[model samples]
Target: MKRIAVLGSGTAGLHLSYALVNSGAFQVTVYTDRTPEEVKRGRVSSTQVHFGPARAREAAYGMPLWEAGPELESIHVTVGGQKLFTGGLVHPAKSVDQRAYFFRCMKDLEAKGVSFVYGRVDEERLQELARAYDLIVDCSGKRGPIAPFPQIGELSPVTTPQRKCSAGYFHGVVPLEPAGVSITILPGAGELFEIPALTALGPVTILFIESVPGGPLDVFGGIKDPESFRDRMRAVVDRHFPAVAARVDGEHFGLCDERGFVQIAVQPAVHRPYCTVGGTLVLGCGDSVVLNDPITGQGCNTASYCAEQLVRTLTEEPVGPWDERTGEAYWKRIRDYVTEVTQWSNAMMGPLPDHAVGRLMAAAADPAAADRIAGWFADPATAYEDLFRSAAGTKEQAERQGGL
Candidate 1:
């Protein structure tokens, strides 16, 4: 059997494993840092609400959209209380429980005959794996140990620690619009996202906020207790976003694992040797290679996109000298798209670009502009706009601010 080892059984690792097993040409084994149950129970931020294209990818991956309990509706957008134009931000944008959906992928892949190797991968363990498999894929995510992938090469969108994010999923909160997501951007202050989700446990609401670093959330500072976290969150909502303040309750959240405030940046080298063994190469995929700041909720979508490309490349060709080429191609295909998404994400961290603000004002005032920007989220290319087009008109924002 042609053997491939994938480190990190997260979304990218699991999805690629599923694709390869379904092909029946490769024997795929996934190595993860936690048990299947632990992996299943792991806490992740209320992070993903897919655009139509992303949902399509999920369906293609054989993740049951119906059983996954997706909430497909629309997205509502506003900046500084000025309603920007909204369109099909995600034409039928859909969401699912990150934890549940992840496990479901694992279960289906196992049923189809893929193997799971659970535990952390030290260098020696990886070497043993390298000796056995024809190829190795690192999907170890942000905290990956196998790859020393700290942000390097290009200047990242966030140089210093950027924002602190707090989030939780609630059981009830009547949405403001018809089955869509909501975004409220307070210039240079914070960003809020509310999405209705269909969890296996039941329907839940995900309310998340990102604030300017060191702004005022002292309670979230190096804290791990649930009581403290929820209290801090409630205080924040009450102080800044009082409209939905009272609805903030800890009753629904027994524990929140995805709550953390970390700096955000974008980086992926186009031609790095993922790993080498006697001239053989193992590559990094998913967030290990490219982690878009979750600022705009593109992490899952990007993971899916990379997983698809990696699957196609691994199955279609032989892994030898061309492995480097494959890695470059992997980086090439995602670089532009990620750049667009990252730029857009970085923009959310600060004051909305005046032009973007103007565009929003124009969109709210002009229906056409509203639809155009909203469409950009689902299919950026279709909008004839680059999601990463710098917020600085003409001048790249990175250069204009000389900040990045």
Candidate 2:
């Protein structure tokens, strides 16, 4: 049997481990810093609203018990004070807090006899593991740049972040009418995504504020407590989003737990995703390879997509050397989708084009147009081909901005 070492226990790592374990073609072990208990009680990771395709991948891997809330059927996009459109999705999406999702996945994988090693892996340890396994896959996410997977310079044109994000899960906000993601795009400032989510505390609203640095929404820099964070978020909503602000009950609004809120800035990035260490080629997956700005809600979904692709490539290949040729082939399997997602995600962070806004206007007038637009959330590759690609004049405009 081929031996594999999977590092990190995030979405990609866990899903890949589950698939390999179920295949019985490889002996797989996972390395992660946190135990299932630790993960359940840890600080919040980012909000994940997994769409239909991602959920299908989970079910295929036989690890499909991830609990989720209402079907997020529409996307309500508001520009400034005007409601641009309330778009509908063909495949329903669901939001699950990462802490709950990871913990459940880890426990399920453990019951299936996958080995779990608890500790952080530095360069020396990674080199050691390289010699012990036929393949090593890193899904370490923000806690890693674990391998020397060089940044794909063309794909990663920006070295600094475009937004400072202040996001949290809370219980006091009123839910949207159709129960979907409420996207408020504040042009020249940033965007706000309000999602109805299933969390450890049951269904709650996730408010993710993507703020342009030094702009009106960049207000959560030094926030510490739940009350303070709530106050600041409420104030921002009051000033910039009157409709949403009116929904917040000032006295009751707060984070779901002490660990529910987070403040951070994410600089979008991409890497070549494979590198040699101790004569063994190590592969990268998920955020470690193609980290994007969270404006489009593609991170977890992309991770799921990549994990399934890698599993397909490995399962189809003849048993042989896990070398450069094998690595290149696997990269080819996921390269196009990865590029499409990176392109569309990066384009979203910049100013919205006139034509893109025009589509939103048209969608507001017609549900058929709205549903077509919403399909992009279910399958982002379509966004590159039609939505972002044609609507925004993305190909030429992206070139001007030095995008890949």
Candidate 3:
């Protein structure tokens, strides 16, 4: 059997393993730092998923929504307390407990006959594993083993100091509306994303805020424990976002990590087809290739999208020299689309254009424009020709909108 080693059993690794196993010709062994049981139980990132990407990635693995749900029905964009706009599955948002979803994905893959190994993958370890497998795939999201390659200016573009994000899980009262999820953009200070998700505590909501470099959270003021964080979150919402704060009742628990904001970013996105030592071929995906800022919640989608392209590349592309020359075909397939998403995400971290924000508000006021924007979020490539390379507003839609 052609052994394929997948480093990091997180979302990307597991998803790629499942997809590879389904082909029935390759053997997949998942390597990770934590034991399967420990990982399945520990605190993981809190995630709010939209139906379009979630469903697309799942189908890529031949899995069903039963692991997560029937699929969230819709998503609404709002600010403060007032509803700005409402839209349905032109793209939908489904809230999911990250741990539950990750483990479920792991379980489903195991049942399909894929293998997993637990250990940290370092430079030495990766090279050792490379000798044993016919191919190696790095699905290490975020903290995964990295392959040193030439740092392309835009290909791996990133600003120093990653963005900080603090998120919490709360229970008690349900949200006022029932679209499955609500995303409120605060623009300057931060943005709060509230979504109804499935969790051990039954159904609940997640309130998360993303603070840029110099934002208020820099002092680590509001958001320590459930109570203090609640007070702090309340203060912000009360002053800037009364509508969302009003829905705050009962108890709210910090997801994990008392740290004010989580910091992460990477060279926009880069993939080296046959990353190797000597001449062996190694592939990478997810945060390893590009750890996108979590602001837009596109992390999982980025990983899965890479896996999708990898599977097809391995199947059709002549498994070339497992060297730089051979790996080009794999990353090239989806680079344009992935690049657009990554660049757009990076741009979002910067200051929001006043006129653009005004236009967003206007769009929110007009459901049609909001719906179009929602669809853009769900899948920018579908609506825009070059989302990664060009600036955010330079799309065909923007030209039609008359530069807002």
Candidate 4:
């Protein structure tokens, strides 16, 4: 069996590991900085909704499943306090706290015969690993690829972060009717995303604030303690998002745990996903390669998608030295997908284009359009078409009319 070393244990690393081991074709060893206990106890890192496709991939890989959490059926949209329409998803999505999800998966994968090596893998240690393993797959998430994978300039247009993201898993927010994710866009200010999720403590609501820097919703700066974060979030909701505020139960409204909140900003970028380190081929997956703003909630879903593609690439290719050719094949299969997702995600961070806004307004009047809008989150390629391709078509039509 070929020896493969997978780094980091986020959705990408874990999912890839599970798929690889299930094939019984290679010996997979996961190198992560934290143990399962540490992961379970650590502060919440992200908010996610595993859409239909991502969930299907998980099942195919035989990854651990969660019996709890609400099955998200629709997407609720509100803009500037005005309620639009709720679009139903064809296949339901689910959000499980990554702290719990990652912890459980790591433990389960180990039991299934995947090796786990704990502690940080620094540059020296990484070089050692490159020499030791036949191939190295980096799934280090936002913190790294560790390997020098050159950034793709065309894909990475933004140099600074578009949103200051503050998210907390809370206990007192009531679920919307039909049990789905709620998105409130505050125009130039930012957005509020209310997600129903499952954690170790049972069902909790995640309120994620994507604040345009220095905007009204960017109020969590310098707030270290949970009480302060909760108070600020409550105030923000009450002031800016009254629809959600109306659902908040004041007496019990607070973070589910002290560590359930995270405050960070992401400078969206995409990399070439492959590099050579000490003559060994290194491949990047998930956030390490296709980092984008979380406004669209595609991080975990994209990671899951890439993981499965990596597995397919490896399985289809001949059993030999996994080099740049292998990397190119994997990239070829996923490039268009990664591009569509990244572009759509980046587009969402700015003001919604007039055409895109027109579509949303039209969706409010048409259920079929609304349902298609809902499906965009589940399958982002449709979103790219709606937001970009449609606009391009309109521009071409305008040019032709002018020429005539």
Candidate 5:
């Protein structure tokens, strides 16, 4: 049997390792920096809502089921203080704290007989891994690909971070009706996403702020203490997002734990997912290859999607040396979907186009339109089409006018 080495244990690495081991076609080993216990006890890593399609992929790979978090049925939208429509999802989504999710999955995968080597994989170790395994899949997440995968310049257009992200899981916040994710957009200032989530401390609401740099909502810098973070978040809500503030039970409101919050900013970039390291063909998956801003909440979903595609590409190819051709084939299968997701995600970080704004206004008057908008989070292809379709039409119209 062929041997494969998977790097990192985040959504991408764990998912790919599970699928590979289940297939019984390859001997798979995972290298990660953190152990399961450490992950569970660590600070919150990200705010995740695994929508319908991503959850389905996990289920197919026999990943562990999470029954704790609220079943997100709809997406409640509010723009500039006006309550918009609630868009229902075709399939329910759930947000479990990555601290809980990743830790559990790592332990579960270990129990399933996947070898786990715990340590940071540096350049020297990576070269050693290249010589040992037949294939090395880099699922190393935001911090790296570790291998030298060339960045695709055209796709990596955004060189700077678009939003200052501050997120925390807290108690005493009321959940919205219909049990869903709540999105509050403050136009130029940024957005607030209130998500009902399950953590090791039980159910909590994740208040995520995507603030434009130096904007009113970009207030979470330098406060390292949990109490300070919690107080600042509360103040920001009361001052800016009154809708969400109204649901805050101030007497009991505070972070679920001292380590339940994180502040981060992502500079979006995309890289060609294949390369050669020490004469061995290496591949990249997840954020290591397709990083994007969290404004659209597509990171985990994108990682899951790419992991499944990589598995399909590997299994379909004839048994032989996995080379540049294999990487090209894998990239070909996922490029279109990745483009759609990346474009939509990047667009979200900027001002909403006129057509997109119109769609939101129309959704307030039409439930069907609202539902379609909600589905965009689950499937970004639809969002991409909606945003670009108008632009394409406008270009054609200009061409016609010029000819006339």
Candidate 6:
């Protein structure tokens, strides 16, 4: 059996480790920064809402035994505080608190007898691991492309951060009128996403604010205390989103737990996902290679999808060389998909094109158009061309395409 070293235990690493562990085709060892217990007690990392494909991958891997969270049936979009549209999805999406999800995933992997090393793997350790293992897969997330793979300039089209993100899991907010994802775009300001999610504490709401730096939405950058964060979030809602504010019970509005809130500034980037270390080729999977802005909620789903693709590529050809050529082939398999998602996500961070705005208006008036737009989140690959290109005649096209 080939020896594989998977670094980091985020969505990509855990999924890849689980798949390989069950395959019995390789001896997989996962090195992570923390153990399951540690992850459970740590602060929130991200607001990971896994769409249809991500959830399917988890179910396929036998890790879907999560406490039920809110069923995301549709997407409600508002621009500049005006209602754009509310559209239903063909397949539902779900969000689990990362602290709970990551912790449980580690324990699951451990129960399956997968080897896990706990600690950070710096350059020296990574070089040593590369020499020892037949394959070294980096799933270190936003912290790296550990093998020094050069950034893919064309693919990484952003230099400055478009949003300073503040996200928290809270109770006391009234459920959405539509009972789905409530995404409000403030145009020159940032965007706010109110989602119903399953966390360790059961069903809670996640309010993710993407503040455009130096813009009106940039308020939570200095928050450190939990109470201060919640109060400030409430104030932002009251000022910008009166409808959502009306739903928030001011007396009870706060984080779901002490560690259930996170604030970060994310600058989107992409990199060449493969590189040579100590004469052995190491491959990058997920965010280690293609980290896009989360404006469109593609981060976790894309990572899960890419990991599964890598698993298929690596295992399907058992007798192949695990060298630079193999690494390059693995990159090729996921390149287009990653690039498409990145471009589409980046496009969403800026001003929506006139045509796109018109489509939003049309969606507000037409249910078929609204459903088509909502389907973009469920299976992005299928809707990429139509969703991003032109909004011309979308109502007719949506009717013909059967509303994604």
TM-score of each candidate structure, all chains considered together:
0.84, 0.95, 0.84, 0.98, 0.97, 0.94
In model 5, the runs with Cα more than 4 Å from the true position are 394-404
Misplaced by over 4 Å in model 1 are: 66-70, 148-152, 155-157, 217-219, 246-278, 317-322, 380-404
User: What is candidate 2's lDDT per residue for 5-96, written digit by digit as tens?
Assistant: 99999988987898788788888899999999999998888888889998887888898576747789898888888887777887788988
Model 6, which residues run further than 4 Å from truth? Answer: 387-404
lDDT by residue for model 3 over 178-287, one digit each (tens)?
A: 45566776656667676666675466666666666586644344433545765565566557667766666636433333322232323344544346664677777777
- At residue 238, candidate 5 shows an lDDT of 97
- For all predictions, the C-alpha RMSD in Å is 4.9, 3.7, 4.3, 0.9, 1.3, 4.2
lDDT of 3: 0.64
Tens digits of per-residue lDDT for model 4 on 74-106? 999988888889999999999999998888899
lDDT string for model 6 (106-125, tens) is: 88888888889999999999
Residue-level lDDT tens digits of model 5 in 1-404? 88899999999998899889778798889999999999989999899999999999899899999866799999999999999899999999999988878888888988888999999998899999989988999999999979899998888887889999999999999999999999999999999999999987889999999999999998899999999999999999999988888899999999999999999999899999999888888999999999999888899999999999999889988877789999999999999989999898888888898878989999999999999999999999899878887678877999999999
- Two-way TM-score contest, 3 vs 5, winner: 5
Cα-based lDDT at residue 92, candidate 1: 77
Per-prediction tally of clashes: 2, 0, 7, 0, 0, 0
Candidate 2 lDDT at 402 equals 93
- Candidate scoring better on TM-score of 1 and 4: 4
- Superior by lDDT: candidate 2 or candidate 6: 2
Steric clash pairs (candidate 4): none
What C-alpha root-mean-square deviation, in Å, does candidate 5 show against the real structure?
A: 1.3
Q: Who is ahead in TM-score, 1 or 2? A: 2
Instruction: Return the lDDT, model 2, position 321.
Output: 80
